[model samples]
Target: MVRILTSFVWLLICFSCAPKEESIVQQMEAKGPIPHPTEAPDQWLLAHIDVETTGLLPGYHEMIDIGIVMTTLEGTFIDSLFLRIQPAHPERLSPGARAVNAFDAHKWAQLGALNRSAAVDSIISFHKRAAGDNHVLMVAYNSHFDSAFLDHLFRSANKTWREMYYYFILDIPSMAWGLGLKDLNSAWIMDRYQVKDEPHIADQHTGITGAMVNVRIYKALLQYRQDLLAAVPVP
Candidate 1:
């Protein structure tokens, strides 16, 4: 009888300690909607992203730096990310871009190995955590070029970004057009919004700074939308 009771107790403990099995989606649903990442400036958490490339093309040119800043939805800057990379050689620095960023090719050569794949992984991981399962709007001054470059990199990486299904990339220039406004240059947005003290220079081609500029631009655009909505009279 004592042995039988012990066996039953062990059975109870085993059942109680059993791990529950659920699909990834089921687990996500149980956790409720993941918090949406703040890609634009607003009253809540916001993320500003930028990148500096060796040239116009991402894969062929290489990314030298990546920058991001997090702020409140109210436009108050909070945290920031400024990472420098060492890309492979033969990276042609445009005379125009070189004039601003002033990165000495010889100096940059000392940084270390070029890990573009690792950089992309970092972006994907960060986006996944920040945006959760919800799609986050990826805004760029010219998303066409930036987006295409990103696509090329991801496709070359042997990882499919489609698994996430949580990316919403929008070009600010295009957004302006969609709003029936002419294409606004980054400088124009900066000047109009008076976002001089935000971070980064538009001409320097510093990826980090460029991303920060995009964030500010995104905020300004949002404000523009609000103004438009306010201006229109209700039917």
Candidate 2:
């Protein structure tokens, strides 16, 4: 009888710890339809995310900043959040990397940047509120680079909650290629769109501004794609 009770308790613990299998479609169905049908159109969360790190090398350098902008599929701006973290290993931050990001370890130290754990928790909370039941579709300039660090951030934050975000990300450069836009840097893209912002300038290149620029680039590329598709003759 004692052995059976112990085994039952263990089973309960295991079951409670497992990840719940629920897709976005099921979640939307449970919540019913969205209020605005014509206003925002499609439902998924469009997140233009950017990360600034100590250096380009993954694992070797820590992420110092994170920025995300949540928008509707129709390109309506919803909300944005920016988070910064202080590295435990600041010695690894090379002068070139620091100069590129305009980050000084001593300055951030004096300013009292958020520790890794706190920054991670805050970012997670912000994402949950922004995403809600809608699927999170991330758009980044160079997804592979950012994803490497973000993957580390999630995995390092809490192993249990690593599944909190989307598995895949969309690259803005790839979108531009598909849309037949010029394969140029974000500054050039912004120039083509006449956005009137010098976001790529080294001093102005914080994660927040970077994310905003990324979103602008995404919207422009999407518009180009739509125009091309509409112009195509039906087979």
Candidate 3:
């Protein structure tokens, strides 16, 4: 009887693990690889994004703030969006993160704070409006850290993260490294290009400010790439 029950449980497990029908998007994704950032489409929306979290605890962190600045490839501003997400776990705020983000006990109750679903909706709406038929590139200073948090945010919010942004994320460090920047810090590269901003102190380093910093860094990197190509003698 025990053997029969085990077999029944095994069958149930296999049934639950079976793949479901793929959506159209999933089918399309399976067809080909996503485009790389270097291969810009005819029209593309570049969104410089930044997020401030409760901590650096990977999936455990709660996003306390978000900033997005959308624009064309030439840096023509399109739209900007900012959100303060009410933390699901305000108690998770670390000492360092608390100091950097500067969130107080009353901060989450402010008029700007949105719940996770609303925050996700706001981001999707902004990106879609700016993108249209153009590809969207989510640009961040250090994409891995930001993207990991965002992925968790979306998953936790019951939203599809891919719908809001393209598959390829453009990282500033990659460009900095490619251009021979030894430090690989956004501030260092920005200083080299003379892109000035307010100091990254406690309360002053807002998400919007961080996003704008990313935009300047991206613009500077593009110019450097252009200069490199121009300086290279054609074979």
Candidate 4:
């Protein structure tokens, strides 16, 4: 009788200590859907940004190149900025990253890549010119990845990400997922939306090329949503 009672108590303790599984509905409620813009589309601007890094981690890796394609919220072309930033910590450059980005030290040197300070200044100036007093919305294929590196870059230059951009980021994959896309991969989404093939070669992928691809994907997704809504007959 005592052994049974002890076993029951142990089981109860174990159950209490175990992490509870959160329901899908609870998770959805916690995260919520991406919020709609409170203001008119034309009133805002989108900074389609892409950055090529030395590695994956922000502080460990350095941004070697940054590309920003500014557009009106409705996807009207505004202006673009591309900066080849000289890596501050060359020692941190990883072989995998080098293979992916095809980082050529000699070529970057010949191009006169901007130093970290100069790169940050240029980015700030670009945003000021594009947005004036308003904060530009950041749009990226993988916003969390790019934003982490970008925020680190800004911090390294004694600046904050919020100085030039809004707090909320617009991620291409998230947008596609929200639009009911089953396959979130860029290739799949592009094919589904009939977006043109990426022009840059895999070995020589540039930041500008990535930014352009992301912009096109975003525009295509927007159009797809519009067409879907339009197809539904109204009363």
Candidate 5:
């Protein structure tokens, strides 16, 4: 009987693990393998996105703030967006996180009640409008964390973020390593590019500031890659 029960449970788990059906948007977003760009290099757009949450893990945490800064191959700020949402699960806020983000009790209540679905809808719409046909190279400082949270949020909203994102996420930390900048970060990029108006707090502490830092970092990385390529030997 125990063996039979174990087999039944295993079968149930396998059923649960089956991949979800792909949505129509997801189908449309799929692309074939892209060929390498010519020496001139195709224009690459970068979107610096940041999110301040009540806790560390996505699906488990509540997002308090969100920001996005968009730039082109040349690093010019084409557009930006910032929004603060009332935390859905106020109790989720950790003391350390609150202190870092400075979202005290008073500050929290000031944002007033927010419609979570409406907020997500508005942002998703904005993201679509901003992105258009232009492929966005997302440049979050720690994209693993931010992307996980965003994915969780979209899942919670009954929407697949991968569909909206076109199934591509160019995380900054990984990009940093690609540029031989392992252990380097937003502050390093700022100093490398001599960017003015440094923030007093950590990038993750303030969503807007974090987004701006990501934008700057993308620019620095692009310039770094260009210089590196220029230094390469040719036949």
Candidate 6:
């Protein structure tokens, strides 16, 4: 009787320590429609963002600077935020990355660049002013690249990226393709739309400049699509 009771107690302990399975209902509920950040569900603002990173990979690389340009759905300028972040792990910076952004440690120190925490705080404040209570939809030329680095930055600062922006990202190249633009290359699309040319020199590649260019490209695409639809004539 004693051995049987002991076995029963051990079984009880094992059951208690076992990991709980997630309920399918709970998972489905969590994926239910997300409330629109703005009063009008269809009218959330766009956040055109660009980031200059220390490397290509997220966990291994770090964001050196970020540029965010907020605009209305119709592409009217709202506000902008640019932050130069002092590298937390400079040793991990790739030589090719340095060549691209001209990441001079001395110049960054002289400019008094914000550390990760301060940069994250500034980003949050900027979003608050631009988005108010709602989240902005992220737009970028190569969104995945920028979003991944930004995600790492936010995580490192112990902040949630979802609070500031939506999970769905709008890609400029994809938009161009959807609009029947044959060339998906940024420079080609920009030239097609008569937008200003991006800088040619490697070191001239900065976040704010790229962000501004991307925003222009997005606006151009929107205008092109509108013109095309207008030419179609109403049935």
Best by TM-score: 3
lDDT of 5 by residue, 1-235 (tens): 9999999999988766443334534555576544322332343566778988888877777777778887765778877877776766777788777766766445656765344676678677877777776656666777788888777666655566655453567777787787777775445655777865336563336788878867767777788788889999997
Local accuracy of candidate 4 as per-residue lDDT tens digits, 159-203: 666766666899988888888885767677687778875555534
- Candidate 5 off by > 4 Å: 1-44, 186-189, 202-205, 229-235
Report how far off residue 76 is in candidate 1 (Å). 8.2
Tens-digit lDDT string for candidate 3 (16-77): 54432234246336534555546755557788888999898867878888888998876667
| Candidate 1 TM-score over all chains jointly | 0.61
Give candidate 2 regions above 4 Å deviation: 1-41, 160-162, 186-189, 197-203, 230-235
| Tens-digit lDDT string for candidate 2 (1-235) | 9999999999998775443333323433454334443454464777888888888888888888888899987667999998777877778887877777877777777767788888878877887888786666677888888888876665454432233445557788877766556555755556666765535555567778878877777777666667778999999
**Every model's TM-score:** 0.61, 0.75, 0.81, 0.80, 0.74, 0.81
- Backbone clash total for model 5 is 0
Give the deviation of candidate 2 from the true structure as CA RMSD: 7.3
Question: How many clashes in each candidate?
Answer: 10, 0, 0, 0, 0, 0
Question: Which candidate comes out best when scored by lDDT?
Answer: 6
Looking at candidate 1, the ten consecutive residues that score lowest on lDDT are: 19-28
As for candidate 3, its clashing pairs are none
Model 6 — TM-score against the truth?
0.81
Pairs with backbone N, CA or C atoms under 3 Å apart (clashes), candidate 2: none
Model 6 agreement with the true structure over 10-46: per-residue lDDT tens digits? 9998775442222322333454366675557555888
